[model samples]
Target chain A: MIQKILYNFKKYKFLLQQLVSRDFKVKYKRSVLGILWSLLYPILMMAVLAIVFTNVFKFSTPGVNYLVYLIIGLVIFNYFSEASNLAMSSIVSNFSLINKVYMPKYVFPLSKCLFVGINFLLTLIPLYVVIIVSGTELNIYHLLLPYVFICLFMFTLGMGLLLATISVFLRDMFYIYGIIQTMWLYLTPVMYDISMIPENFQTLFKLNPLYQFINFARSIILYKNIPTIGQWAGCGVSAVVVLIFGIYIFRKKQDKFIYYV
Target chain B: MKKETMIKINDVSMRFNLGIEKEFSLKQWFVNIFNPRKFKKEKQEFWALKNINFEIKTGEVIGFIGSNGAGKSTLLKIVAGVMKPTKGSIETYGNICPMIELGAGFDMQLTARENIYLNGAILGYSKDLLDSKFDEIIAFSELEEFLDVPVQNFSSGMIARLAFSIATIVDPEILIVDEILAVGDIAFQAKSEAKMMEMITGGTTVLYVSHSLEAIKKLCSKVVWLEKGNIKEIGNTKDICDKYENYTIKHMAGNYDI
Candidate 1:
């Protein structure tokens, strides 16, 4: 399977590059800010959430700056939601091409992940800006952030694949996922600290994969500490498990896609 | 010397489920799980292609002739590797260029120049190859001035011209053409037909599907006449075309059931 994947990657590398760039171009086409919006959007959202949570909601983290903490959670969770949402409809939207030519179907969803992944990386700029502006000390542990980003990316790609496949069969998945995403945002400690959750339910909340990912980022960025072995294990396992399951389900249903699409 | 076989279709069949509910939401699916009678009533099997078997030797130009709903497009798609057959398999040697639809991958929001690279990449052309052939494609397409304009602004004929130029830029071992020859204006149609003739004579194995008997007779040495998902006849182009013409004439006169 690895060999086949590698071969396909090499074979379709040009197409993949084109697809990612196309997504980037089409997204910002008419907007005056163009690519700059990716950098600015997160910062603006973080500011609004930071003001409301600190002033109105009275949320706080003991040692960490709330602005930095909020941005990290926002960036991570936003990537997951946005990437999965776009990738979910990737295959269905490209049925015109799928029906006429012979290219790997997975490229559609994979390219969506890559496009959003690039956007996620750009949002990291605003994240660091908030860190510096908020007077949070930068540490060498910050270099380890890529580890978390990779984990988040893998998890999102997997979810994207799963959702893309499901949405092909059930058109209602689009709206259903929107409601689930909103509920998920509230469940995750993005604006509020984890300490605010009740003790008994905190354990259940940690079981949410996004919770592990957001917490892993916080360890390296906000707390300026390397993630514990347990943190590493949690992030790695969830990412790999979801990705493997996604690939399995996607490959199984891909052949049938031509019929339905 | 005997030529090698470039393509072989072995008992390929395609079955489509003509279910009453073409699409189902998760809620509906869960609700219907307990309704066995409703589930049973929804399934209606449609065999688009039935036990299709054929082979094309190297450099052989084969034409597929059929009336509407005769599975010509399905068979073409299967041969192009866009769709898998239900019960059989197809083996083909060498690269295949399936011009099933012109500009199928063009993003109308993108400029023509951008689309050239995008569509070229989708067709498996490397950046270096597109760079080298970029001028040639534009020159052939006759849209050099309109390169910066978005494809959505272009007329259908311009899009077809651009697509044709990009698709025929490289000669592959196998070429699958499905009713794309009659594209653009009459002048452009003649030009594309000439280009196709050049490829056919240059030893590219071609599988062609067209309703135009004149085009089939002029290009294909052999023809496969399909009727309602079955091959009614397969032989020399002139012979098969003659029989197909008579069948269509008879059917039109209401002497035949369908």
Candidate 2:
């Protein structure tokens, strides 16, 4: 299976470049300001939320500056949402390619994840600036950011591949995706900080691994503290399980996917 | 004797279920899950093709003629590997190119040049090969000025011209063409026909499916007539085509005009 994927990757080299390039171009094509929109997204969201909740309206984001903390979690959650929301529909949208050729089928979602990944990387520059301007001290704990990001990636990819396969066989998946995507935003503790939850509920809420990821990222970037070893292990274990199950189901279901598509 | 063999499919069969008789709903899903057949499930499993076997030699053009849903495209798709046969094996030694569904690689959102590179790669062209052949493809497609524009803007004829141009470039040992060539203009169609002839003369195998019996007569050396998922006739193109025509005339009560 790995050899098959590798061979297809080599065979479709030109196609990969074209797809990535097309994605880049189509994103910025018609806008008067072009790719400036990329910078505008997180920055604008951070500012608007910061103003409404903290500095202007005094809605309170706890001890951290509403702008900085929200921006941190927003950047991470955006990556997951962007990857998953589009990933669910990746195979369905690209029926043009799926209908004709026999590809690995996992590549479409992975390619889309890469597209959002590029955006994530782009969003990081401003995130670092926010980190600096917030006057937060950096330490060895900050070095672990890459590990947290990988967990986020694997967790999202697991779900993305699962949703792609399920949606292929079931049209009801589309309706379900809309509801799930909406609820998932709140589930991840994106717009609101996790501390708002009562202490009794922390264990229950953190049981959802996605919130654990957001909390882990926030603890490191905002508080300059790494997650406890137990939390990290939990996130890691969940990530591994989700990805393994996701791939297993995707490969098994993919043989019939062309017919469904 | 050195016999030229292009493609071989042995005892291929395909069956599909049309699914439940009623529209699937959440309640129905749960009910059916428990009962396994709570809804009026139609046992609509039918073989679209059964025990289909054929072999075409190098430089031979084979025409597949059948009524609607005769499993022609399904058989072609199996040969293309776009689909796998349920119960048989299909083997081809050379580069197999299938045009069973024209513009399968095309995305209207991308420009023609972008699509050409993308589509060509999907069809198994190496980068260097496509780079050199790029100009030739554009010239064949006659879309030099419109190359930068998204393909959704192109007419179906333009799409057909580009697809055919790319399809022929494979120099495939086995080439599969559906009824897509009929989309282009008369002049372009003539040009396409010339391209197919050149491929045939160069010892490539061509398997064609077309409603135009006239073109089939002109191009194919062998004709396979299929009816209800089985081969009705397989022999010299002229002989079977003639008999098939007479049978069709009989089906239409002899009202057809010459």
Candidate 3:
């Protein structure tokens, strides 16, 4: 499977690059600030959430700066939400091109992931800014953040493939995913700490694949600690498992997409 | 020496479900899951192409002539690998550039210059190739002044001109042209036709589908006449086209059967 994906990547490298750039351009075409919005949007959201949770809800994390913690969670979760949402609609949205061309179908969803992945990387600049402004120590462990992001990207791409396939057959999946995303946001504890959950339900909450990813990011950025081997294995396994399942479903159903779309 | 076969279609067929009750929503799917009889009763199968068999040698220019529902487009799509045949197989050699619909990949909000690259990439042109051919494409399209303007503002003719220019920039081994020659004004149409003629004379194996018998006669050496998903006749362009013209005349004169 990896070999086939790599082969396709090499064969369609230029097309993929063009598609990603096109996505980037189209996203910011009319905006005055353009690409700077990617950096500013997350920071603005972080400020609002930090103020609300700290002042209104009075939430606190012992020994960890709340600003850095909130920014890390917001950045990672925002990427997950935006990437998966964009990918879910990618196939249905490109029905015109798909009907006329013979390029690989997976490129649509893959391109959305890549487009959002670049934005996610840009948003990291704000994340680093928040860390410095909060006076958090930058450590060697911070370099390991890329590993967590790769895992999250794989997971999001897999979910995107699955959703893109389903959305082709059923238009209702689009609205249904919006509801699921809202519920998923609240359940993943982006605004609150996982310790806030009763000890009995912590394992159940950890079962959410996103929790593992968000926790991985927090461990590196906010806590200044390296993730344990078990945590690393958990993120990698869940990402790979979801990605494989997504590819399997997407490949199985992609041929029917031309008809339904 | 006999030329190599560029395309071989072996008993290919395509089937589409014409049922209106297709499960397009999760609610409908769930309702049908509990009522299997409703799901089974609404199936209406449509055979777009049936038992299609043909071969085109290298450098052959083939024209397909039929009424609107004769499966000419479907056949082109299957050969282009855009759609799979329900049964049988197609063996094709060399690259195929299918101009099924012009500007299908264009993002209307993107500028004309950006669209050139985006559409070029969709047609499988590498960046370096597009960079070199960029001037020729712009020159051929005649949209140089509007390069910075978004494509949404361009007239439909301008869009078609740009699309046609980008698609034909590369000469593939097989060229699939579906009913898109009537683009832009008469002069532009003539210009595009001449460009197509150049490609045809350059030894590109062509599968041309058009409603204009005049264009077909001018371009193709052989013709395939399809009727109701079956090949009614396949022979020299003159013979088949003559027969098709007669059949059309007879059918138009209130004679339903020929």
On a 0 to 1 TM-score scale, where does candidate 1 land against the true structure?
A: 0.96
Off by over 4 Å in 3: A1-5, B20-22, B255-258
Task: Count clashes in each candidate, considering only residues at least 3 apart in sequence or on different chains.
Answer: 0, 0, 0
Residue pairs in collision within model 1? none
Ranking by lDDT: 3, 1, 2
Q: Candidate 1 lDDT, tens digit per residue, A100-158? A: 88899889888988998988888888778878888988999878878888988899999
Q: How well does model 3 score by local distance difference test? A: 0.89
lDDT of each: 0.88, 0.78, 0.89
Docking class of 2: acceptable
Worst ten-residue run, lDDT, model 2 chain A? A53-62
Give a tens-digit lDDT track for model 2, residues A1-261: 899878877876666666666677678876898888888887777767777867666654766666667777678878887898788898889877777765556777877777888889889888888878888766788788788788878888888999988877676787888888778777667667667889898777778777777778778877777689977987798888898888889988876766554
Angstrom error at residue A188, model 2: 2.8
Q: For model 1 chain A, where is the 10-residue window of minimal lDDT?
A: A39-48
Per-prediction fnat: 0.79, 0.43, 0.74
Which candidate wins on TM-score?
A: 1
